[model samples]
Target: MIPAIGWLLSSFLVAWLSARAAIAYAHRRGMLDRPGQRRSHSIPTPRGGGVGIVVASLLCLPGVLLGTAEPWPPRVLIGLLVALLLVALAGWWDDHRSLPILPRFGAQLLAVLLFAVASGVAGLSWWWLPVLVLGGAWSINLHNFMDGIDGLLAQQAMFVGTGLALLAWGGGQEALALAAGCLAAASLGFWCLNRSPARIFMGDVGSGSVGLLIFAFTVMLGRAGAWLLWPALILSSAFVVDASLTLLSRFWRGRRWYTAHREHLYQWLVRCGLTHAGGGVIYMTWNLLFAAPLAWLAWSHPRQALPTTMGAYLAAAALWLLLKRRCLRRRSNKDRHVAA
Candidate 1:
């Protein structure tokens, strides 16, 4: 207990300091995100603040692993750590210079494959193996996609990490719980600099690495039989619903799905006059009001987990449709007024 508390404090401090340094470094290097057509912010802001998050998490990992009482297989722990490092490195590289689509995706795929092999997915049915690999890779990318506004990604990380920690603790998975706690603390630290009227952005470094970490934790929980996948899905329903629906909508319209665009419901809301912080608040509220309760029910009643999970997604999907319609209507009204 004492060691865990220390770990959390250390993690928070490390991440905070790292983020501060990253902001200064970004400014010095002129690694600023300039305002553009698809952008949400007006002023240039330093990016790659997620470098702090990635650094802090990795630095604290050894202590957390050693201090925890839970018995994790050495091989599994090493494999996960190595995979996370690879993903973080790739994201860090991309933040400095845009890697082409194929190379970027290839890196992600390679990391996911390492994760899958480490997690012993090969023992699963052939079909399940591919599904797990694809899902893990997609999870990493979807996080990058969702990181378009201030505080959104960081706050989401805090909520999901905290939820996972609580769930793991409830299930008596001490090691996993401790690790998740550290992640939550680190995210909270990052949020200080990442809030609206932001001083710095997380860039791909933080988003990609954090996404991979969450997916890895989910897999770890499954392997331990401490939690089911449904609850995990419910916990991150906001990102899942928005990213999935937006991608499908784009693909259906024959748009280049890989292209950068501000077509996400959250993005539309920002364009419709919601401040960046306000946009983040909406997501946090959804997690508290809708996703959190359902996640709790799923965790407490494993038999009902699947249905509750589906219910959460359905509600999120409905909300997305509603937001999209409202955004479009507002645009149409402005257009009509202009014509008048």
Candidate 2:
């Protein structure tokens, strides 16, 4: 217990210090995200502070290998590191200057392939490969889409990481628990600088890497116990629902779904007059009041895990549609008032 606590504290401090350095570096490099038509913030802010979280998470690898008695191979550890670096490096490049979609996607796919290879996903047979590749790619991009406002992705990462950590611990998976705990702690450190009225944005460097970490955590948790994946999805319901629904709606309406836009439910919350912090709180509230309880129920009743997950997602989808419609109506009413 003491060692675990120490690891978490170290992760937090490393990320905190890294975030400070990233702030200075972003300023020096002129990597600022300026306000624009589809942007959430009203002022220009330095970006790529997510590098702090990435650094902190990468540092946890040695701790996990050394501290646990889990007999993982050195090759696997090295592969994981290489995979993380590939994604982080790609995102770091994009942070400095936008990359064309094809190149960005190529990097993400290669990282996913590396992750699968390192984890011995091929041993499960070739079929799982394509599914995971697609899922991993979606996980990477959905996070980038959802990271439009201050502290939102950080908050979600902390919540999901902590949730998975506890679940892994309960299932007697010490390595997975430690890894997930480190992610939560690192996110908490970045959150200090990332809260509303932000000091620095996470940029692509942080958001995409965090997404990959969460995906990795979920896969490990599922490996420990297949039933646990249901709860993992439950914990991630807020982001998944918002992003998936928004994308589907855009596609259904024949909009360019691949382009950046202020159409996410969270973005609409900001457009509806809530502060970035307020939108974050709303999402966090659902995690706590809705997702958390259902996750606990799923954990306690393994037999019902799948059903509980399905029900939770159903409710979340309903709420998302209702809230999104309300936001649209409010915008329409406000527009009428302005015209009158």
Candidate 3:
């Protein structure tokens, strides 16, 4: 308990201080995100604040492993760290200068493939290997997509990390639980600077690295049989639903899905008079009121996990459609008023 508490505190402080430093450095370097057509803010703000998050998480790795009461295999830890660093470096590069989609995606694919190979995912089935690799890459990109709003990505990270920690701890996976706990603490510290009326932006580095970390933790838990995939999916239903539905919507309309736009439900909600913080709170509320309970049920009852997960996603899908309809209706009404 003492070591765990120490780990959490140290991680939080490191992230917090690092974020402050990142803000200063970004401003000094003139790495600012100016308000634009597709943006949510009015004033320019410092970007790459997520460098602090990435740095803090990396710095705390040794302590997280050492402080764990139950030891993890050295190989597993080393592999996961290598994958994280790779993704973070790639994301950091993108943050500084936009990389072509193919190269950026190639980097993500390579990192995921490395992680899969390191984790012995090939033994599951040769076919499953490609699916996992692609899925890992999607997770990274989806997370980066969702980081558009203030506090949204950071808040979601906190919820997911804390949820993972609780589930792993309940399942007696102490090392995994500790890692998740550290993730939550780091996110919380960053969230202080990331919240609405934001002083800094997380940029690609924080979001991409966090997405990979979540994927890695879920895989680790699955390998340990401490939890199955269903609960993890349920825990992340909010992001899964939003990102998946939005992508499908764009693809169906024959829009260049890779292009950045403010078409996400969360973005629509923002356009409909919700403040950045308000939009973030709404997402956090969904996770707490809807996703969290269902995830808990799935985690606690393996036999019912599948049905519970399906039900959870079904509800999430319904909510997504409803939100879309409402946002569309609001836009239509505003258009009519403009025509008048």
Clashes of each: 0, 0, 0
Tell me the TM-score of each prediction against the true structure. Answer: 0.96, 0.97, 0.96
Displacement of residue 286 (Cα, Å) in model 2 is 0.7
CA RMSD of each candidate after superposition = 1.6, 1.4, 1.6
Candidate 1 per-residue lDDT over residues 14-133, each given as its tens digit: 888899999888888888999999999999998888877777778877667555676566666676778788888888888887878888888888887777776674243444567768
Model 3 poorest ten-residue lDDT run: 120-129
TM-score of 3: 0.96
| Tens digit of per-residue lDDT, candidate 2, span 1-340 | 8888898998999998999999999999999999999999999999999998889888886678556977445655666677678888999999999888899999899988877776674243455677777888888889989999999999999999999999999989887798889999999999999998899999998998998888877876776678888888899999989999999999999999889899999999999999999999999999999999999999999999999999999999999999999999999999999999
| Candidate 2 positional error at 200, Å | 0.6
What's model 1's TM-score? 0.96
Off by over 4 Å in 2: 121-125
Model 1: pairs clashing at backbone N, Cα or C within 3 Å: none
TM-score of 2: 0.97
Better of 2 and 3 by lDDT: 2
Using lDDT as the yardstick, the better of models 1 and 2 is 2
